[model samples]
Target: MKSYSTRAMALIASAGLLAVAACSAGSGTSSGSSPGADQSLSIGLVAEPASLDFTTTDGAAIPQALLGNVYNGLVKQDDSGKIGPDLAKSWTVSPDRKTYTFELVDNAKFTNGAAFTAADAVFSINRVKTAWTTSLKAAMDVVAEAKAVSPTQLQVTLTKPSNGWLFRMTTRVGAMFSQTGVDKLATEPVGTGPYKLGTWKRGDSIVLQRNDAYWGSKPFFNQVTLKYFKDPTALNNALLTGTINVVGTVQAPEALSQFTNNDKYQVIEGTTNGEVVLSFNNSRPVFKDVAVRQAIRQAIDHKALLDTCFAGRGKLIGSMVPPTDPWYEDLTSVAPFDLAKAKAALASAGVAGTALRLRLPTLPYATSCGQVVKSQLEQAGLKVTIDQLEFPAAWLTSVFKNADYDMSIIGHVEPRDLGAVFNAKYYTRYDDPTLQALLASADAGDEAAQTEDMKKAARRLSEQAAADWLFLLPNLMVADKNVTGLPANAITESFDLSRLARS
Candidate 1:
């Protein structure tokens, strides 16, 4: 097995080969001698997990931040985004790529002490396939059926060749659960991971204890605590005051200097899949014109927007695909910053003086980003009024589902998939068969071919100005200097406990 450092270097070489391509880890913790044994570690979480039942929640970063510790999928991802054997000791794919056969790890036992087997694998896969709104259901829906060949063997048959089967397995949605364990899911969740749920106080914190009977290497700490906080400043203060041992994914980039400039902490930083976009509702007449959309894209300065919003924490992205993705194309050239050109294009589209209504939800970065966008659009001779919603649910219901607004600024954070813009069923208001065909072609073929196809599709999207590409959100992890072994790649889920040790 390759170390994370080696695998990460390979990942960067394969993904970012452009002249401006460079990868560096975020700084939160300091470089010093390791500390003595610490029995426990506490993390300040931005929000509580949506649901303890992994099958129900959307499995976004917040949900997976907690669920990742409590669940074990058939396979697991290493710190560097490579898939490794977990409950399933090994797996072989059929030549056609439609069937996958997995060999179970015989000694693997669920937290409830039930022996994990092929039946559990069949049940878990089918559960997600039938579940209506699972985050990974779209990907798993291709599974024709999952059956147990024997107590120690399982086979999954897919309707077509799915490139995401193995990648999806590394997520919590693919986590295996025993029948008895799932029965108590609402109150107590059980899995084969290193940690078991110890206690839960709704809206407060979740406590996890080491599963001593774990089949793999155990965690160094006896217990782990996840503390929830809605405020980034509060979370940073906690880390500084020693109320929490670590802080993962702090939303406010302004607070980063508090840890980055300090010598007592270590910070691991890198780009994540959360590529922010200035989405235009294509159904609206004002934005329906491609000229207007392209004008809007060129109007806002990517550098100024990212600098004002995240204090220059992340890099400018071209399409929905972030720079961290292997298929990422530096299409920033497609939409260059030209306020005069933007103004001319808007006037040509006959919507130059219209005050477009921009509706935004109050996420950590939304308000500031929206404000900057408003200023830039106004400068480009496009009148704009900003309406900020207090809650994300309201924004989703009104702006996304109902199409109640003209435009909005938001970040789409799902990793390794661009279904948000490519899939017709998703929230994008565009209805183009040509673009859909290009996306399908991009998703098919061998690895190298897929990379070329992805670049083609990304370029097409950029040329058409699919969505106003803003910037790729960066992943930052801050911890006490004594802590170690944080993953250096873009994955937010696999923050493995076994990797951490206070020196």
Candidate 2:
């Protein structure tokens, strides 16, 4: 079983990326204390140019926080986790399940003022089949071809059955970019979303105002500001001074301390199932054996991840399916820490005490997971070497796209649907045919059939160790008390911020 656990790296990192980008968010915010809630809103976030453009990592380069503001997909998911209509009003799947038809809404318009239609949807998917999609294969693999049947009707052809194809369409890659925007967007992007584009200062700041002519919900605030910060402390300072409105997954043990006496502030912390785990590119030589993978899993103390890195505010995970999601199989959550068993597994794989050097990107998720994991592996009898780079990218270049790492650490989110993580990684060298088959079966069935299929896939993934599913925890979203209408979506946070009833 090749462990595909999406430890916090992939999960919170995107939220973290928003925070990284928050440092300079206040750089030139009209230079004053925000006057009134009705006109302007400054939200804090951190983002690295995960991709300068789409060619970087998958077809979608921007983090959810940024993309949530600037891009509109066929459907929109709110921060509350509701999947609602966006560019497309409704869609129907063919009985054979190879085809998916969608009806586009009439009023949708791109930032450039071009009409959005079924043709653009087809263009987004089909264009990815070409050179524009190199980094996006894993995310785009299940999609075969996309085409339009009419000006407002679009169809998608898949290589196999896919129940969650529509959801994937709303992801970053799923956002529709103007045909004209595609050429100029490498530097200046144009999209159909709630907020219009503002000046994008690479290392410093980003500012946007509500698209008053928005097609959907009207944003409560007029101006939306995003800044980038390299230091977590500096970003927190913005929050302290009230220069920023919110911070996602920022590490501060005393975060409560900062907000204690402030009536205008609020803190939201809960248990989320997002976990961070290591993945061995099964296509690579050293990680070819299940025993070696098991040994690595056994070596780390997930509880320590919670204590040291999370400041005692997280859950330890032992499976690939997060508990917060319904499709998650209960059994994967049962692994107990057994150092002896882990060592035995390593010996079984003939990897005990062997030189196992790998590249790990240290960012977001639990702080110090890479460093802590390295120390644990050494104690478990593996010769460890560390090549630290930025999060997500290091793993992307080394494992998924280029296959350069010995072992990689990543945080994976078990999206609302379980099949997402599995389909992206299964048999892409992880080699568990059962897991792939279940996901394929899901695509072929109805909603109920799909859920059951995903549950079954969850079981297979737990058993196959496609990766450690890890723990289910709550997402932390801190905002000004004035920001109203925060929806209680399950842990699966949607990006639809327009519906938020801010004061």
Candidate 3:
């Protein structure tokens, strides 16, 4: 079999190529050495996530990547954030750019010997679009519908052409699930990927064995194990002690520095091209006007925030679309970083003296962005409030369903599809002719036309101040020196853990 590394190289040559894309690994103990233990790979995660289901939460980036051990997508993004073939051996887009017809690879099957077919992809997309309880693809509302036309063919129709529709389908939210497996064995998952779930010990660790049946290239070493840690310190300690072979989620810069200084570990940085943004309820009377948006932008110094909270490891961003992306725009015409301009803009809009109260969602991201913005607003002479949130009660109701904040920070990770993140940040109109024309030209219609529309959209996103684009962040992955092929942007899920091996 071709090594996973070679496969990744070929896949990258095929996708995620244009990306140039870092955060620090939180502190941890190194287990094993550079190159990792021989028999099994042990990994760590930052949170005890709510679900292992792909459609639920994107599974917190770390575990979901390993969970490829048990789940697979028909198509997935390569490191460059470009779509690459997965279960689908090949595909064709309609000339109109609205229909995507996929042809499944023959002889593909899950661990349980169940055949992998195009029907699974259709079922997965439908589940995502129709399921009300899922949090995975809230940003992806572009799919008009998806269905299976034949055993090996699936079709996805969009309301209109959306340049980002393809990328969105390759995400975790779009991971293909076994129809029978999902109906009966969701708790006991099965996937046609590189690895298979070997054992699940509740509240403990999950073990994954290499899937010899996988049709594509496979990982080098045999198995992978993921351990959960509420606090990163414990996860790091395990790495240092050699109890755990690798740690996946690195949220602390100091931790990354510590790991880098040690000769025992290798740090992998990739462009997640995701952001931690401070969003506004545009429907809210105060945030509706562009001047107030300018004031909020003026009050918060993104550079200062990055230095203070992220340990100076972050990209200062100003819009929903990442500046590095081809579709990105500087919108030099939008509000500048000038504090006086912010204040003057607010005064002209007649919202400067008004006290604006907002709540900040803290659990998702590393810091309380609300508190940070609150201080900035106060400095700008506007009274501000930062209400900290916690738990099932505080999270959904207060943030999404209720729009319960004057301002709040939201986490958008693995947004390979700009539409997946952009919609949540802006463009919520249920229907519009102008947006329709732009999106039609975007989807699969024409690259030049789509690029032009996307450029216009990016500028409009900034001019409208859709969301105060706070920080464009890169995910920092710290791997033991023993680990190889787990490089950044290697996969859509990023860093397939199946290949890591200890010395």
Candidate 4:
């Protein structure tokens, strides 16, 4: 399996020439790639993008899958994790590592037929600091200024040397958008990508059509539709009946088994950068006690979660970063499962028999894991009430943004970007000046120093019992046997409908 960073690199790489090379005529053979007929596809999305505004969107899966196809960034990363050119065909960095100058691709144009230039890049990146995306401001906090040096040239100055700047550029927050289309982006996004948004039937489905005027190599499929199914059973049924060519997310152990065993389907399983966690809202009265947090961490079994929740498909994670990631630390034994230790901690915290609210979104894995955790914590003398929620809107408005729950079980899906959640200012509410400082050092240092500091930060978070770090989430794509060009790994670009085909 490729590491999470490697997967992210490929995801960003697809925003550049790599995607064109992947589906071009000489690359391979598939029904969609054939010269004669115009191919089409229907995909079942686990959920819709929270909003069409990619710059401020928070849902991990849909944004990662949709951004690369709908928007373009200045730089991209290759399979080997080397930085490459994307919308900005070339760039030069100053010795101080604070200023970067990029040469934009002149041929690129937005879906509205407006030309793309350095001015658009400047406006788009600078938009991060605006009130529209306040939650994501920290990610680009180091960027002091961005300006258009010329029609096709752009310059960006940073507050400090940032090792992760290029990685940050790979995210949707850094994607360039036409300044004129800013008003319409929230409802209908316009970008210089392979496909144009066709129709979005609010809760039902989204349709995308190939952009005939696209600057890069043409995608194989003429049209692609992403359907949404609220129930996992209904989603599975859609796939089984061939109503949809692909089922985007499938984490249930039984569903995984059924899909893998069924010869009629092509089941692809691999590790995503997503880390499933029993996240805590530290500001809450119950979680404010360190002993209570430690007790909950000790009560749950990481290995058993892998076995029960995922059927041993994912890896045991000690922290937010997965083991496959470079900055990961071997802290799996940091909080071992011990019922006695858990009981003692709960007793010390004076919450041994107190009922704690455990909020869970509608995801199958989360609901299933919540049941297991409820039982384990109950056995350890900790009471838990599972509050299941409707996805996207409910979770986004309450649990994620408002920090309305005491504890919740969900996966943080972006890889090499865990820094976004480390601060108390953004929902998690576990604040430590030492951690923030260490992360700052990591962000400014060289690759080795960054890795070391990140590891230290991860250790600090785990030692504080900030959250119960659970198993790494796996990406499982179940498709019809005839479908082709399904992404090899779970990355931002893995679900690019443009690459798929009916073989």
What overall lDDT goes with each candidate model?
Answer: 0.67, 0.57, 0.56, 0.70
Q: Give residue 192's lDDT in candidate 3 (0 to 100).
A: 80
Question: Which candidate leads the pack in TM-score?
Answer: 4
Any runs in candidate 1 off by more than 4 Å, and if so which? Answer: 1-38, 183-187, 390-392, 399-404
Error of model 1, residue 381, in angstroms: 3.1
Per-model TM values vs. the true structure: 0.87, 0.82, 0.79, 0.91
Model 3 lDDT, full chain set? 0.56
Taking the tens digit of each residue's C-alpha lDDT, what string does model 4 give over 71-100? 777876544335688899899899999999
Scanning candidate 3 in windows of ten residues, the lowest lDDT window is: 1-10
**Candidate 1, residues 147-203: lDDT per residue as tens digits?**
999999999998878676777677555788886677657568888887888998876
Global Cα lDDT for candidate 1: 0.67
Model 4 worst lDDT window (10 residues): 12-21
What order do candidates take by lDDT, descending? 4, 1, 2, 3
lDDT tens string, model 3, 1-503? 00000011111111111111111132111344332225567777543333344443322332343334556677765544456787887889887777888888877887778888777777777777676244445535777877778888888887767666676556555566777776544356667877877776655676777788887656665777767554556767888888876666565555677788899887766544455656677667887676677667766777777777666765665665555466776653365567777777777887767876566433424344456677777777688766765422344355544556676565444443334333433322112245445554666557787777777766666666767766755545566786655545322444465445444
Off by over 4 Å in 2: 1-38, 59-61, 78-83, 94-99, 134-150, 155-161, 260-262, 270-273, 332-334, 364-367, 391-396, 414-429, 469-473, 486-494
- Considering summed lDDT, which 10 consecutive residues are worst modelled in model 2? 19-28
| lDDT by residue (tens digit), candidate 2, 307-383 | 66556655554555555455655563445557788888887777788886656554544335667777887887888
